[model samples]
Target: MIARRPEGADMEAKLFGSRLSPFVEKVARALQLKGIAFTLVPPKSPADFKRWNAQTRKMPVVEIDGRRVFDSTLILRRLDQLVPEPPLLDRDAGIAARQRFLEDWSDESLYWYAMALRWSDANAEATTTQVLGSIPAPAALRPVLRVVLRRQLRNQALAQGLARLPLETVVDELGRRFDELLVWLGDRPYFFADRPSVADLALFGQLNVLQSGPTPQAERLVAERPRLADYFLRVDAATAERRAEPGRGAARGVDFGTTARGA
Candidate 1:
């Protein structure tokens, strides 16, 4: 069940994002897990300038205590400062470094792979039309919009270094990475530590995309990593529990505060 806002606490802050965006979902899940209060707002479109113009030209911009924070990593860091307990980073430097490396890889490399799969799937053309069509474009310019979207997909593939790789190669590499990550995680309850860390958040976000999308390899990977799937389920359950408690506004309704401003 979704948590209800406490009556006397501070009003929940706003988050601009889309349901399909894994990055946004990651931040939202973090907030939910931390018992932080927030309101969600969907971005107007992928190219909605009004939403992007306000901050880092990105979706998932978080407004807290009247300050806006952009980027998922920075937002997670800010949340850590607000609630240091149940830490997201390890105290050990070496381990933390490794976790950070994996986090970065998941965010960039894995995310691109997921995107590639998404764009090349059988439903690609229909999905693209639905998402892009929402933008208010001139009737006479609809054909131009289609052309622009195709080019954008091509550009995204090129940017991710997957444009030159054959589709089979892309699938193989993604499968290989998933296998390696599962083996690395082993029987641990979390990816990098005894509890969920930033790395887990990053991995879970990307993995959620793969599982929800029309990718066969992604589905296979999840099936192979039953423990990892359980970890995600636990995280979701924790969030739900935190949301279910009545009048637990101490942490729930507080702001990200000065630390979020880098002050």
Candidate 2:
């Protein structure tokens, strides 16, 4: 069940997750789109995994007014309620349902394709090295940790079925998905309208990984579809501008505060 916001507490929000996670990006993008301020709290250690969300050890979990909310979809829904001015979902029930369906497919299905490419043998070495190197770990421990984590991630993907598929198969399927997106998007700035909706944010989450993550396959595949690349760029630029607006107080909203060291 979704948690309801409590009254009479500080309204400031804090997000706990890594930028590498597309799920986390979804929540962050929502905050920017809504003009709501939030602090980012990336996990710094293994123990940090369970800090924000004990049940899932997952991220994009949000703490607002002293209440903890997990899952990007739920987080976005909660934020929509707190600051409803710019609606992220359509008021029309049919449109809203379509948006929700797309978001779910992106999160549950498209995400695995991105993960498969990211942790595949061809990309694993370079990807893990860079990803682990960015963490605040001792240099000596980083190399060994990187190998261990990469294996674990790759195993998880294999067990999930995507990683077991041949890389060629994964790439071909991803290409087809991109083609579908091109047709749906056409000249529209977003999936359904000029302004981004929840579906757009959810789709962008995985696409962000493809564009910026360590996997070369994603970058190459995206390059083949110029329209998709342009759309992703547009979304990135538009949302980033929200944080840089003159009176938005971007720094304050994104301030690290003191919780960063712990997680």
Candidate 3:
């Protein structure tokens, strides 16, 4: 709540990830929350991404101080070290442990449900069309790329065991998770306190994907539960301004008059 200038403005971080990825969003939100300046750069093509990260072949990579770091969790850990003023983890060991546990569950388990919903036959065409439309692929090749990407994601979901379940089952599981979060959060602004934490960022990323992504299944499920819906909005509103100018550090007491919620 205090006004202070962010340090190392000259060393602006560079992030490698697509807009649609929740994992990428997780890192982006953390950077915003920490008031770090960073640029989000998406790959021009699959081969371009392969050249950047040949190992994991994943995104949300952060390049800082001439060093590149990959993985959302690891990127967050590094950010905490780089910008330690507003710490992401709590000082209390037990609270920190719980935050990490929830983050892991949200990232690994809850994520699959969103994937399953997006890639399922019910949502595939619409989701693929919407997502691929933003990619810088040729108009003629978009349809083919969409089919290939959708099929690959569907295969991943199937292998992960979520896509094998009935649609109702997936929805029910998602609902249960939402209910659990509502109960855990109670009336608090964040998962732990009035301010957001790493756990909040992790869950918010997935919730954003579910509620605002191409498929409306998760959003529809949230509609039946106002608390969950409001929580999503809270995170969305908090990050709205930062989403607009991700490369700029948020100034203390900065007023973003017209924020783009769910952008």
lDDT of each: 0.65, 0.75, 0.75
In candidate 3, where is summed lDDT lowest over 10 consecutive residues? 251-260
| Candidate 3 pairs with clashing backbones | none
Model 2 clash tally, residue pairs: 2
- What's the lDDT for residue 155 in model 1? 72
lDDT of 3 by residue, 1-263 (tens): 97464443334688787756788888877776766667777766666666777778888788887889988899899988888857888888887887888889888988899988988889888777757754788878876887787888789899999989998889888888888888889888888677677888888888877865466878888889988778877876665433233455442222122112354
**lDDT assessment of candidate 2:** 0.75
lDDT value, residue 82 of candidate 3: 84
Model 1 / residue 175 / CA error / Å? 1.1
lDDT of 1 by residue, 20-98 (tens): 5667767766776555667666654456635554555766777776677888888888777766655678888887887
What C-alpha root-mean-square deviation, in Å, does candidate 1 show against the real structure?
A: 7.2
* Per-candidate TM-score against the hidden true structure: 0.78, 0.87, 0.88
- Residue pairs with colliding backbones in model 2 are 43-263, 44-263
